[model samples]
Target: MIIPFIIIALISLMIHVMEPVKEIVLDRLNGKITYPKTFIDKEHRTIEFDSLHVYRTLTTSGDFAITGKKIFIKDRKFNYTWTLKSNECLEYWSFMVWYMDKNRPLPLGTAFNEYRLQDFERRKAEGFSKPLFPGTFHTPERTPSQHRQRKEIGGW
Candidate 1:
């Protein structure tokens, strides 16, 4: 009886610890899991997604593609197709979750657009124009050390 109780306790402890470990492993593999249901834009503006937009487009090959879009969820480009069939519509969260589960690449164009928009906003905030390019052009005014450090440490 004592042995059974000890096994049960050990199993319970393992179950408790496994969840966090799994999340950590997933975070490392997939980068930080951001809940994009609501997020901030480059201009320090809060972008919220109250509802999802679903649309169907016909490809030149005569196949139909179903796509989903949500404000500030992914990038501004709406070219990522979730399904080839238009039988059912999926909301933003559901589509994103499904895509992640299937280990699909999160829309790269959208991510790139967001990054560009953010950079543009940051430059605007700093009273600059023509965009900052690494190893290409230097700014007239010195950037703060903190900002420079962040630039060096680059992550999405």
Candidate 2:
């Protein structure tokens, strides 16, 4: 009857009103200043020999803590451990590596951007972790105003 419709519509409205906003505030109080863009240092990077065939050319600026001597690359098509050290990696930025299926350098996959911390009790409840290989990385030179804010301790 009309009564059911009215109840349903009212319930739907209430639910919509209670739903969270489109943007969640990441309250990071730390005064950390990251680069305006995400750029990898190609000059100080090296790809492991026979590192990738379907996916060739891996580069880094040495920022990860590779205690296992190297990284372990595993994907739907390729799998290999890396021997990169923190000293050899990039300094300030975190990294995301992904595998490609061709004999050339493909863009980072979904993992690079689909990073989400499962825990809610952590310091920051918002923002996702960087994917291993993002489909593409943005740089200050590439897109200017897209990313010009200083990232805080919580999220950037």
Candidate 3:
């Protein structure tokens, strides 16, 4: 009887842990959940996240530069840095969609357009700018500084 109870307990524990894991697997399979792929454009000072349904971009200065199919900056700034929440990015995309087209669906890569330029100009006129430390967003891999320092010490 004790051995049977121990077996049952192990099975119960496994089920409990695997329930969530199974749900996650199903969600991923159904496209209900997605992993984000981040792209950093050091020359443009922009970071982009592509999470299947939604695409987002921000300047190093924390400005919501682009989200989904909308652009928030008329002219790109290379010397800015900041962080933003995913929800904030989604909200910006929704707002731009509503503002641009109420009835039509936003096309892929819709963020690159004259309308975005106009919107960015309007926002700039309203003086909406957030500046943060450039070092706030660092690449996961080795940076130029690391390379430069190592090179200086002849420690390739």
Instruction: Tell me the TM-score of each prediction against the true structure.
Output: 0.19, 0.21, 0.16
- State the lDDT of candidate 3 residue by residue for 1-156, as single tens digits: 699999999999986765421111113112222112223332222222212223345444347544333323221223332322445665554443333331121223546454544433443343432311122222111236533543444322
Model 1, 1-156: lDDT tens digits are: 699999999999976765331110113123234222212222222222222234444334335443432232232243222232333333433444433321222223454344444543454454442221122222221236534433544311
Q: How many Å off is the CA of 108 in candidate 3? A: 29
Q: Candidate 2 overall Cα lDDT vs. reference? A: 0.30
Q: How do these models rank on TM-score, best leading?
A: 2, 1, 3
Residues 1-156, model 2: lDDT tens digits = 799999999999987776543321111222111111112222222233223333223444568533322333222222322332344343111232212211112223444243212221121233323322344444221122322221232233
Candidate lDDT values, in order: 0.34, 0.30, 0.34
- RMSD vs true structure, all candidates: 18.2, 22.3, 21.4
Model 2, stretches more than 4 Å misplaced? 25-156
Off by over 4 Å in 3: 21-156
Number of residue pairs clashing in candidate 2, backbone atoms closer than 3 angstroms, sequence gap of 3 or more or interchain: 18
